[model samples]
Target: MQQIDAKQAMAFVRQRRDTTDPTYLFSDLDRERRQQAFIASVSHQLKDAGTFTDIGKMQGVLDAVSKNIVVDSDLNLIQLAQQATSLTGGNISFSTLPITGFGTSPDGASINTVDVKQVQATVKELLTPVPLAPVPTTTAIPTAATTSPAAPASEAAPASGAAAPAPATPSAPASNVYADSTGALQGGAIACVK
Candidate 1:
């Protein structure tokens, strides 16, 4: 952001006077007032862009008023302060203009102030990050109680004969290997032996 120097500012004032444009009327102020306006304009742009809240809080002043006041992601804030120092004779200081909402009726604008609740909530959230809950673990094999048991043989009996109680099929004793081999391996472990 190239700042208008005293000479340049004077030229701008002259140009405005000759062109009948009032927008540039303030370009001819004395050094103190000119510097103040310059600083204010720059600060206004920075605030509008959300660069920093108050100029008072600016860390490095010199870089703030430099060749490029643009606050893009790649812009270096330190450099901006250094530039500011070069422009305003080190007398320039950062300040957040007091905000109280004053503008035209329909189209309004404000600066240097934000919702207190919003700011507090944001700070609180940052200070205490949320913790994630632990993920649950599930067993691969379903337990008898956790799963439905097979229907009784009588209930599954053929329509006519009552199924003879399914031939009294004896329950197999539980063993390490027997339990290991599921129904798909009914031929015993040897059936899986290569």
Candidate 2:
């Protein structure tokens, strides 16, 4: 596991390029742009590559290399290349060098195996995918965003527009509860006298 900074990795890439090719001229400005482009491209490539790893049990190993892809199996490398093609407009191929090695079990135990050519061929087979053009789709369309309403416009006060309000009608006063000089209630429903 290694964290490679953009500048350091670009310098390494520049060193690896063939200096003898005069046609491959790159200035300092170009180098900077290339570095930024490469970082962006690889970031996009990894994002696409994440989808492939979600479908398998080897996700732990995939996660380890998800952010930093330096060593990976042939199958993973092919998947990464395919993802790169889908995410970035670049064709990529996968291949492994010829080397003899012991096989390992899923639990990381070494197993006895002696076929180097088969491994190399398998790696070569992983590189056969061609670049794929991104299909036009609406899956990533953003949700409907609501904007804030504008403030109300200022208005001049109206002149001579107010009308006089109608006078409220007086409610009929309730009948007087007090009795007359005789000291008896006038209504028969209530028996109290004033």
Candidate 3:
């Protein structure tokens, strides 16, 4: 892979050429993947090249990007950068929302068709925090001297005839939305994109 400057990076991310090539970007989703790849590359490069540690390089990058990037009014760039310092290249991953199929719009423009319910479900799954596995507990066995006399099964049963509630089960892991899709992009390297 070749190193690219900001201008080349912008062009690479924005280009919509080569629709016929299976490996190249043609759809809006492909462009988004390219954009995500670019961001990952830049983030990795910034950390790899020690740009964050170098005030001059950091200022240069800020000066260049501040012109093109927008942020909330109260966002502190320094604080954000500080926070970002803890994020490694491995921390970044990107995936586009799943699309059903391609369709022609009323205006004859091509569009990706998506299932709204599936999208909602996928989003909900992505947002829901996974429950942590229960820590293994050790129950000490009582010695014969310490153990109480065994009670009859009927006596141990609740008077109301209700059974004890079962322990809650952990939710299954989220399904990978990108498993059958090509829109997944990972960080830590310069990903080839259209």
Candidate 4:
């Protein structure tokens, strides 16, 4: 139930070794990267005291995570490790936050500056669970507009010898998906994402 911070590690290193070398070792890493490292370290520690011998190790790390980790229950750990591995699309949480732009510091030590609030806000957005939108409900009512032509402008007079305007060919229905094998489908039809 104890929290470990980079500052604490730095302090310990400083105390034991009597030097500040630890702080300088990984200070170049940005906030997101550092946070990611922390999450990964913690996740590994939980699995086998700093080893990844579990089957869900990769999937666990790829899921979203927050700086604040809750450990009262193993499953209630999305804040520290997202568990919806099936939907993660093979993404990981330890990635670095995008940089606003590239520039040099006053002291000439190359640096990547990020807005503190913006970065945290973005991280929160990633951690929050999004409700799946309700699929639009529509009756599968059949209509003939696509099958039948416009009744040839009912009652309109035709010009002398002008070949009756060729009946317009029915256009292809929109297909959002394509299948390798066909099943009970006509040449053209509207397909949803499903």
The candidate that wins on TM-score is: 3
Between candidates 2 and 3, the one scoring higher on lDDT is 3
Q: What is the TM-score of each candidate against the true structure?
A: 0.19, 0.20, 0.59, 0.26
User: What's model 2's lDDT at 168?
Assistant: 53
In model 4, the worst 10-residue window by lDDT is: 185-194
What does candidate 3's lDDT look like per residue over 104-123, in tens digits? 99999988999999998887
- Residue 185 lDDT in model 3? 31
Better model by lDDT: candidate 1 vs candidate 3: 3
Using lDDT as the measure, the top candidate is: 3
Q: List ranges where model 4 is wrong by over 4 Å.
A: 1-70, 74-91, 97-114, 128-134, 142-194
Q: Is candidate 1 or candidate 4 better by lDDT?
A: 4
- Residue pairs with backbone overlap in model 4: none
- Give the alpha carbon lDDT tens digit for every residue of 5-112 in model 1: 768865543441234665643322233354556656665655555445334455443254333342333444454444433333343343322233423444563223
The alpha-carbon deviation from the true structure for residue 176 of candidate 4, after best TM-score superposition, in angstroms, is: 29
Off by over 4 Å in 3: 19-25, 53-63, 135-194
Better of 3 and 4 by lDDT: 3
Per-candidate Cα RMSD to the true structure, in Å, reads: 29.4, 37.8, 11.2, 18.3
How many residue pairs clash (N, CA or C atoms closer than 3 angstroms) in each of the candidate models, in the order given?
A: 20, 0, 0, 0
Give lDDT for model 4.
Answer: 0.45
**Candidate 2 off by > 4 Å:** 1-12, 15-29, 49-194
